[model samples]
Target chain A: MHLLEIQNLTKIYEGKKVLDDIDLHLKKGTTLGLIGPTGCGKTTLLRIIDLLDLPSSGKIFFDGIDITASNVKDMDIRRRIGMVFQKPIVFKGTVYDNIRYGLKVRGKNEDSYETEIFKLLDSLGLAGYEERDASTLSGGETQRIALARVLITEPDLLLLDEPTANLDPLSTEKIEKLIAELSKKKHTTIIMATHNLIQGQKLSDQIAILNKKIFQMGTPEEVFLKPAHKFVAEFVGVRNVKKGTATQLEPDLTLIKLRKINIYSISHLEGLVYASIRPEDITLSKMKVISSALNEFKGNVKGIVDNGGLIEIEVDVGEDFTVHMTRKSFLDMELTVGSEVWLQFKASAVNVFECEC
Target chain B: MSEIINAFFQAINLIVSLDPEVIEITLRTMFISLSSTFFAALIAIPLASLIHFNKFRGKRSVMNVIQTLYSLPTVLVGLLVFLLISKSGPLGNLSLLFTPGGMILGQTILVIPTVIGFSIIGLRGVKEEIKELALSLGASNLQTVTTIMGEAKYALLGAIILGFGRAISEVGVALMIGGNIRGYTRVITTTMSLETQKGNVELSIALGIILLSIALIVNLILNQVQER
Candidate 1:
């Protein structure tokens, strides 16, 4: 049975629609990663699910009961869920005081959770921090403290909103590891809103890409590798995207015209379409010596940017194309701006999707 | 200059020796002003909560009027309270006129607006996110407000202290409403005004020093709570 269901949820702030027609469902003990760009109503949806805020119009069913029904008090339902905000919230007191707040609100005495608190704190690497002022802690420490407080409650449903967006890399890893462990439990259903693609793929049983509404939702590979929406394709880091007309002249091949140049892709799409190719999928060489790649372009290097691990080169054939290659390969090829180079990619590398705009 | 210097020493002597009249008047001042502040808070806090928690038609206008009342002249409130409690006035049958009870009532009326105004600001100082955080943690409506009040405790305390400072430092209400009866209704500010008019500088100086000291202590405590 679905543990949570939301139907046609909408939120408007001063008549500006923030979330429109949002529908979602999650099975029990499954982790759903909600990925979206900033200001995409991810936080708003989580807030509504946690019962912190009401949607402008929607029906929510939790545990198969209509929780959003008029005159229904959701305080009892809210207590069964835990939410950690993007920015850590520390009360005015010691670390122990901060961690004990959730239990305190639920009428649990401090003595009841003392042993459990210490064990949880020690596991989260906050040992001996019981007396330290929580407000004085670093961003990472405070975030961990926030997570610890929520985790100690043993909520059946956990809603995390970009829990590590502000932390350093090491702190981010610590938080991610803890979340990974929680996902492993398969007893606490988790819905974590984040823009980090790898974290979403690694920790989620399902991935839902959202921009005000769910654009696509499926297993990790289906959402990341075979996105059904153009926005999802572009957001998942497809750097070279161009609008073109697609024509099918072969049994399983698509030819797209990019103004002065044409490329081939292995997709069955027609009419006005947006085609995207990943920067890493294209290979660059001084001469045309491709083996099996169906699409080949000869263009001048418009610009070169030294990305830390790789070199990002923008090539201008009729349309601009971005290609990323290792620095060693770039150096060995002696590539520079204004240099003529040939790039090749398999026909399958191009992702073509029909769109109205 | 020599008289002023002598009065300064005499003021210190009176405070250190705990002069009977000075002690009596100071104690009465504390009693009346503290009672006034307590009564005002009882009304102002709930009023502030109503103004803050509700979406009313004229909320902004109501807040604007309350803020404007913060600067209401002490003498004006004194006259208003005096009329309401005087023999020919509506509450005249209660016989509260010319009594410390009347002074407390006057001061309470005088400071209600200020207490309400400052309490609103104090409550507003609590970040909107904190309230959401409290509710997110499963706090009920009343519990969420308790959390917000806890977070704004210092600012709320400061507001109350500000109300008390206004009460203890105003003479018009005490003099007009209490009648400054020598043994019954004489409080710090009214007695100071009388003694100063009579050219007894030292007694006035002693009372002024005590009043300033109370203000300083309130401020020191405020600074402590407000420290990061």
Candidate 2:
């Protein structure tokens, strides 16, 4: 069942449309990842969901109840939907009091949640720091406590906005693990906004790529493998694409022409199109003698950028193209800038999208 | 020159010896100032919090009026309270003129605006993120206000100290409204005025010393609280 649904959500700030007709639905006990660039209204959407900001024109239903209407009380809805902000805000009190603040406000101050609170702290790796002053905790520790504080209220849905954006890599990993563990054990529905694509892919069951609008939404693998829009493809880091036309066709292959180069299409797509290939899909060779590959291009290396384990080589084969190869393969080819080499990728690995005919 | 030195040494001796007359005036001053500051805080802190948290029409005008009141002279407040409590006045039936209650009323009017001004400044200084966090956590409006006040407790304390400092050191209201009646409405400032006019430098200097010491203690306490 859908636990939360937002329809036609719109917010205008001082004549500018910050959020424009956004619609989203979340199933119970599932995590939805919202990935977008800065100022793309990710935070604004989350704030609207939490009822921190009223939408200009929209309807929101939580468990089939309309929450956007003026008659509905915010306190009742907020008790069941918890939100964690990007920056951890611990009040001027002890850690325990900060966590207990929500419970106390709800009239459950002495309801014997000590065990559960401690369990949450332990899971977030914050045990034994309960009595410490909240102001003195480190950034990561404060974030963990903030999360624990919200979770102790046992809200059915959790809205997190860039929860790990300010943390170190080690802290990021810990927070990621904690989020996963909470969702698994408690079956809590979670909606999170983050800029880290890899982390979003790892944690989300469904990914929503939001630009100025809902560019695409689907399972992460589906969206990454076959983005529905140009923006999504570019956002997801599918870099090597060239504008070309379908020049030849067959049951298994289709040929396309770049400036003076002929390239084979991997998919059975026709007409004027943009053909894209993941950099990692292409292999580099010193000479033009490939075995079972359907397409090969002899080109001069334009540039080489070493990125730790993998080196990305930009080659100018009549039209520009990029190929991804490991440091081992690059060393074996002895490739350098201006080196002439053959780039090889099977036709089955290329993705093609139609441009205007 | 001789008068100043004699008054200074005699004032010190009175303070060190804890003279009964000096102690009586000091205690009266403390009581009046503390009561006035307490009353002002009770009225101003919540007013400031309301202005800080809620948006209303005419809020700017209301704030402007408060700021104007903040600078209203103590003598004007004294005159206003004196007229209200004097015989043949609106509150003449209460017969509160020439009493400590009259002095307290005048000082309260004098200090209330200071409390409001400082409280507004303190609560406004609280970060916006803190308010957002509280609101997001489902805190009611009252809870949010209390949380803001708690976060800005030091600044609010400074406001209270400022009010107390102003009320205790003010002479016009205490002398005009309380009438500086000996063993009755005689506070430090009013008694200092009366003793200086009577050429009793020792008592005037004693009262001055007491006032200075109280101001020093209040300021020191405010500094310590802010440091923490």
Candidate 3:
């Protein structure tokens, strides 16, 4: 059974629909990374799931109990789950007091939790800093303190809204490591919302793409490698999007026509469509090679970009298509600007969706 | 000018010598006003929280009314309390008229509006996210209220201090409600008023200095609290 379920959750803020009929489900011990742009209602959805805000129309079930029911005691359910807000919100007190606040509020004996609080502090790399004023700390320190305060609660479910948005690299690593540890516990379910695509993919077992609702949700590989729509593809870094007209072919093949080129993809989509392929999915070679990749285009590398560990080579094959590859591969192939190259990808690599051109 | 200058010198001498009557009046005034402020804050803070947390019709108008009453006439409050505790009045059987308790009652009524008005503004100034943050951490509705209240503690204390200032400095309630009885109910303001009226200008000036000093001390604390 799913540990948490949201059915048709719609939230309207001041006469505008912030979240539009979002449906989501999470099993026990699953870390679902919620990714979206700003103002996409990530915080709003978290608020509703945390039971801190009511949805305009929806039903949320936690532990097989409908939490959105009028008779349900929200505090009882909210106590079982905990949320760390996007901001590093700390009370006006010592770090010790801030970390122990959740325990104290839930009626736990403070003296008994003193050892636990210190242990949490040590794990957060904030040992010996418990005596410091929480409000006086830097942004990174405050974020760690915020995480420590919530992690100490041992909530059955956790909601983190952009947990690593504004932190430095070191603090981000620490928080990410902590979240990874929590994900492996197998007793704590986490739903973390983040705008960092790489971080979300690395830290979450499942990923949900959202705009006003759940656009697509699956394993990181499924969502990124094979997006369900144009928005999901573009958001997940599929930059080879081209509007084309597709005609259905037998044996589950769809022939699409781009400007002055014909490409075949294994999809049922026909008519005016949007076809996208991940940059890395297209193999770039110096010469035409016969292989399983049926869609081959001969073009010149118009631009070469060094992206840290990787390289992005833009090829102009009638339409400029960006291809991603390792720097080592680019160096080995001696790929440079204005170099002739052949782009090849399998028919299945092209994700075709029926949408307005 | 020479007579007023002599009175100023005499007033400084009285203040330096720490006149017993002046000290007694100052102590009595401080006790009654502080007690009234304490009791009034005990009532007004929670009342202000209730108003802030709940959505009710006419809430803005209610706040407007409270803010308007912040400068309510001291004699009007005195007359209202006088009516309640006067002989043959509703609460007359307690014989509280002309007593320190009656004076505290009148002062409390006079200053409740100040505390409530200031507290409402303070609570409103607290960020909305603080309450939501607390609630997300498993806090019940009441616990969240306390969290917000703690966030605005400085402002709330300032409210009480302002109320205490109002209670201590007002003369009409002290005079009309307590009758300014000698030694029993005489306070700084009523005694200062009486002394000035009886041509004992030097004593009144000395008491006025004491009142100014008290206000200065209160203002200093307010500055410290707000700076934090």
Per-candidate Cα lDDT values, in order, are: 0.88, 0.86, 0.90
Which candidate comes out best when scored by TM-score? 3
Question: Where in model 1 is the C-alpha error above 4 Å?
Answer: A12-17, A52-57, A239-357, B1-4, B86-90, B197-201, B226-228
Model 3, A1-357: lDDT tens per residue?
899999999999999999998999899999999999998899989988888788999899999999999899888888888888888778888999888888878999889988988888887889999999888998888888888888888888999989988889998998998899888854579999999999999999999998988889999999988788889888987898888999988778889999878888999888888888778889999998999888999999999888797898899988889999987889899987889999998899898876744
Candidate 2, residue A59: CA error in Å? 2.7
Evaluated on CA atoms against the true complex, candidate 2 attains a DockQ of 0.64
Better-scoring candidate (lDDT), 1 or 2: 1
Q: Rank the models by lDDT, top first.
A: 3, 1, 2
Q: Provide the TM-score of the second chain in candidate 3.
A: 0.98
lDDT of 1 by residue, A233-258 (tens): 88887678778899998879988988
Error of 2 at B11 (Å): 3.4
TM-scores vs. true structure, each candidate = 0.84, 0.92, 0.92
Clashing pairs in 1: none
DockQ of each: 0.58, 0.64, 0.69
Say which docking band candidate 2 falls in: medium
Query: Model 2 residue B17 lDDT?
Result: 93
Candidate 2 residues A1-357, lDDT tens each? 799998988899889998888888889998989999998899999898888898999899999989998899888888898899988889988999899888877778545999988888888888898899999999988888889889888889999999898898877888899889778988889998998899889999899998756778889998898776667788999887777887557786889876688788756777787788888888778887837887788889999998897888899888777888888878888988999988888887777777744
Clashing pairs in 2: A266-A347
